[model samples]
Target: MPVLDLLDLPAACPPGTPWLGLDLGENTIGVAASDTSRMIASPLELIRKTKFTQDAERLIKLMNGRNVSALVIGLPMNMDGTEGPRAQSCRAFARNLDRIQPVNVAFWDERLSTSAVERFLIEDLDLSRKRRAGVVDRTAAAWILQGALDRVRDQATWV
Candidate 1:
């Protein structure tokens, strides 16, 4: 399937296929995946920043292993709902991925996702700063995926 908007994701993916979420940063790429039913998302792994080909290869390997059918990448929009450099970078990454992989790709507005997760880890989870840093990316990826899943569920109710 081709790339799609978050709101345009298919109502149902193939059986046993799951969606992957990505938090693409300059230094690392956080990964998350949904269950087959798409009810929950879990933090998977963090890929260190590398050349585009290397990053794409690593992502494809993970997708192959997890049977991922679609990708939901966090789009970092500005506070005023405008696209910025970060958002452009994400879109570029998606374009590159689409060229090399057959999986569907989509972007989800990810304003404050990382900050929110960091706050939760510090205040509620009481995790140390170092520990939080290690897992924040993956956690943010989960947060992004969960938001997308919730939207999907809500849309299902209307059908």
Candidate 2:
């Protein structure tokens, strides 16, 4: 499957299968997974940055383990709704992953996702900086996945 818009992702996804979410950073890839019902998402694991083949192999193994049929990858976009280099990198990553495994892929605008998770960690969880650093990426992956899940659910209601 090719990279799809968020609205189109739900259709591409098979019923009763989980959706994997990825927050791709320069040094790490934060992973999250949605429930079979697709109503909730949870942080899963963090994959350290490595070669593309290694990274994709890890991701494919996780997806197979969890029976995930689609991916929601966070696209780091500028505030003004423009794609920057980071966004392009994410797009390319999705495309490359599709070529390797051919799973449905979608992009969720991830503007401020990391900072929002950081604020939650500081104010709500009272986690120290060091603790936050260890978990922030995966937590942000959940945040991104939750946002997409909510949108998909709401769209289903209207449809």
Candidate 3:
């Protein structure tokens, strides 16, 4: 399916299936997954980007193994809320992902997600710079997915 609104996910996917979240960077793809209850998102791992096909294959394997019913991809929009080349790249990756694996995909606005993760790591977690770099992307993926889950849960009461 084409990318859907984050709010549509609850209805579009199986109730108890976990969702996969991705924070796509030029050098790496950070991965996260929600629990079956969809209440929390946790970091999974990072995929070092080599080629599109290889990356898609790895993600597909992980999603299938984890019973991921949908994907919440981070869309890095400009500060002024306009989509730039990075957003376009994310969309392209989503399209390609679905073509290979045929799963539902959604985009969440990911402004400041990385910065937020970095801050938490530096201030709260108090990790060294090298250690922080190793985990920042996956942590950011969790941040993005958590934001989407919050919005989706809020919309559930709209009846």
Candidate 4:
């Protein structure tokens, strides 16, 4: 399926199926998964960068294994609320993934996601830089996913 609006996800996806969240980076792909209730998002894995085909294959495999209904990909927008090269890259990746598989896809604004995760890791969790490095990406994925899930839930409540 083509990329759908975030609000359309609950309708597009099968009820009770999980949604996969992705934070793509230059060298790694952070992965998170929402619970079947779509109420909680948790860090799942960090995939090292590889060829696009390989990355998509791994993502598809993961989605299949977990019975995921859709993907919530983070679009790294600029602080000024503008699309940059990174956001463009994410869009392209989402398009490619959609073409490769039939799952629904949506992009969520991800400005400051990584920084927020970093701050929480250092200040709240008191994780050292070295330890943080190993988990930051996946944690950021959860952060992104949580934001989307919150919005989705809020929108549902209004209706």
Candidate 5:
């Protein structure tokens, strides 16, 4: 399947199928999934980054088991809204994943998603630094997914 824009997802994906969101980091791939109703996004788990084939297999397995209809991956854009090496890598990952799994994939602008989640963890949740490190990625994944869900659901701010 092609890599789609956020707005294109609703038409491409089957209704009531859950969407998977990923924060693909160098060391780990944080996972999130929406409920079948697509109302809320919740952090699922993290997959340790191994070989590309292994990672793809694991992700495909997750999609299959979870009935994920589409994917919303966090695109690591620079603060100035420029595409850097990390953004290139994210596109490459999406292309390779499409070849392997053939799922509808969308990229959501994820500038500062990690930092924002970290800040929330520190200031509001008051989590320890170490604990923050462990959950930050997945939390960011939820943040990204929730943003997409909000847009799809036509929430106030997304408009």
Candidate 6:
């Protein structure tokens, strides 16, 4: 399937299946999974970046294992709301994933996601800098996924 907008993803899935969220950084791919009801998102794991084929294989394995029906990738949009090299990279990743896997793929604006997660870790959890670095990507993935899940849930409430 072609790459889709994140808002359009919930409409494309079967009723009960959950979506996978990804924060694809240069060094790692942070992963998150929503509940079957699509109401909550939780960090799953972090996959260290390897070759493209290897990363894709690992992602596919996780998708199958978790029964993910769609993917929501965090598009690293510029703070000024413009697409940049990072956003293009994310779009390319989503396009490649869509081509290699049978599941639908989409992108969510990820501006400030990492910063927000970092703030939560420091202020709320009082995590050390090293510990925050270790888990921030996956936590940011959860933040991105939670944003999408909240929108989906809000739409459900109106219907």
**What overall lDDT goes with each candidate model?**
0.90, 0.93, 0.93, 0.94, 0.91, 0.87
- In model 6, which range of ten residues has the least summed lDDT? 1-10
Question: lDDT per residue, candidate 3, 34-131, as tens digits?
Answer: 99999999999999999999999999999989988999999999999999999999999988877788889999999999999999999999999999
lDDT of 2 by residue, 1-159 (tens): 677888888788778999988999999999999999999999999999889999999999999999998999999999999999999999889888878899988899999999999999999999999999899999999999999999999998999
Best by lDDT: 4
Residue 69 lDDT in candidate 4: 94
Answer with 1 or 2, whichever has the higher TM-score: 2
Which parts of model 6 have CA positions greater than 4 angstroms off? Answer: none
lDDT of 3: 0.93
lDDT of 5 by residue, 1-159 (tens): 788878888888888899999999999999999999988999988888989999999999999999899999999998898999999998999999888889998999999999999999999999999898889888899999999999877843466
lDDT of 1 at 96: 84
Better of 3 and 6 by lDDT: 3
Pairs in steric clash, model 6: none
Badly placed stretches (over 4 Å) of model 2 are none
Question: In candidate 4, what are the lDDT values of residues 1-159, reduced to their tens digit?
Answer: 768999998899889999999999999999999999999999999999889999999999999999999999999998899999999999888878877898898899998899999999999999999999999999999999999999999999999
Greater TM-score among 4 and 6 belongs to 4
Count of backbone clashes, every candidate in sequence? 0, 0, 0, 0, 0, 0
- Tell me the TM-score of each prediction against the true structure: 0.95, 0.97, 0.97, 0.97, 0.94, 0.94
lDDT accuracy of residue 62 in candidate 1: 96
Model 5: worst 10 consecutive residues (lDDT sum): 150-159
- Candidate 5 lDDT at 147 equals 92
What are the runs in model 3 whose C-alpha is more than 4 Å off? none
